[model samples]
Target: MKKPAKIWLWVALVLCVCTTGLNLSEGRWLSVAIAIVSIIGLCVLLFGQRKAGYIVMCVCAVGSFVVGVTQNMGELGAALAIVMSLIGSALVPVITGLFIKSQWKELK
Candidate 1:
């Protein structure tokens, strides 16, 4: 995968690990759900080859929406989830930019 894709994959992996660990430690309801959703996001990021990844991403998005609404989270939480969805969707390009900057710096 491209650098951007790899970055997003790395972020998703980190989020999954962190969220899972938090859930295990604190037993927070949202923690478990976040971990599951992030894990799904990671799977889509890494192995979503044949349009399956897109479908998975869509599922994740909807899942985020449901979580936001069902929990009755205020605007902040809902906005956060929306932002997270956007990040998950465009993570590859964001990561790619970082790589490019780093590479340019190295060259300089």
Candidate 2:
């Protein structure tokens, strides 16, 4: 991966940790597991598990998008904020995953 991709992956890692902490505090075991997968995914991605890394990153992005929308759906008046936030949160992992996926030939 290139420098920017690496940086984004690091950001994704931070987000994964935060996700774990937030879900743990809220007693959401499934989200916590998703976050754990993201953490491990990043590690494996860096260590040459490119295919698994892609799968994990994609899963994390989708998971965050689904969870965030479901949680924020009740805020009818804040629909714009909800969409923006969801996109923003999901982009880190999604973008990072796309970048890594594009570099499949270079990674291993």
Candidate 3:
């Protein structure tokens, strides 16, 4: 992978670990499980040899969308908070994966 792409992957790994830590601290077991899946997806993208890693990334994106949206649905009254949740929890990881797309030919 290109150096820039690798750096993005490392950022993703750190985010995943932080997410796991925060969820565990909050006693949100389900959130933690979802985070673990996301972590696995990032691992596949970082180290796996096949295009299947993209599939894993997409799955994680959708899962994150659902969980992030549902978890923050109650905060709809706070527009700023909702938008931040939508962007932060839902979009950042997908963007991170996009940053790693420089190596698509290698994976293919």
Candidate 4:
């Protein structure tokens, strides 16, 4: 993968870890599990399994969003969850596209 994509993936991994830690502190086991899964998906991306990683990340992102929306948290918490999930979800596709473009250029 390209430098930018690698960096982005690392950032995503860090974000997942941090989110997992926060969820752990809050005793939110399900959120922690989701974050852990996301971290694993990011590791897969770093290891060059682009399609699988992207799919895992996308699924986790949606799961996170749904959990956030239904968790009975206050408005602010729900909004934050929604925003984070959206950002994570969006990043997967952008990073995947970047990797694909780089691969295409190399193939040419």
Using lDDT, give the best candidate's number: 2
What is candidate 1's CA lDDT for residue 35?
A: 50
Q: Candidate 1, residues 8-62: lDDT per residue as tens digits?
A: 6677567657756865686657646755765665565465532344345455546
**Candidate 3's TM-score:** 0.77
Q: Once superposed on the true structure, which residue ranges of model 1 sit more than 4 Å away at CA?
A: 23-34, 72-108
Model 4, 20-87: lDDT tens per residue? 88889999898789878877877876776456766677788788777766674465576675676566
Cα error, residue 6 of model 4, in Å, equals: 0.5
Score each candidate by Cα lDDT: 0.54, 0.71, 0.70, 0.69
Any runs in candidate 2 off by more than 4 Å, and if so which?
Answer: 75-85
TM-scores vs. true structure, each candidate:
0.48, 0.70, 0.77, 0.72
The candidate scoring highest on TM-score is 3
Q: Taking the tens digit of each residue's C-alpha lDDT, what string does model 3 give over 1-108?
A: 777776777787897799789879988777788778777777776777456765665666666656666776776645654576567666545676576566677885
What CA RMSD would you report for each candidate? 7.9, 2.9, 2.4, 3.9
* Cα error of candidate 2 at position 44, Å: 1.4
Q: Report lDDT (Cα) of residue 104, candidate 1.
A: 34
lDDT of 4: 0.69
> What 10-residue stretch in candidate 1 is worst by lDDT?
99-108
Compared with the true structure, the alpha-carbon lDDT of candidate 1 equals 0.54
Question: lDDT of candidate 3?
Answer: 0.70
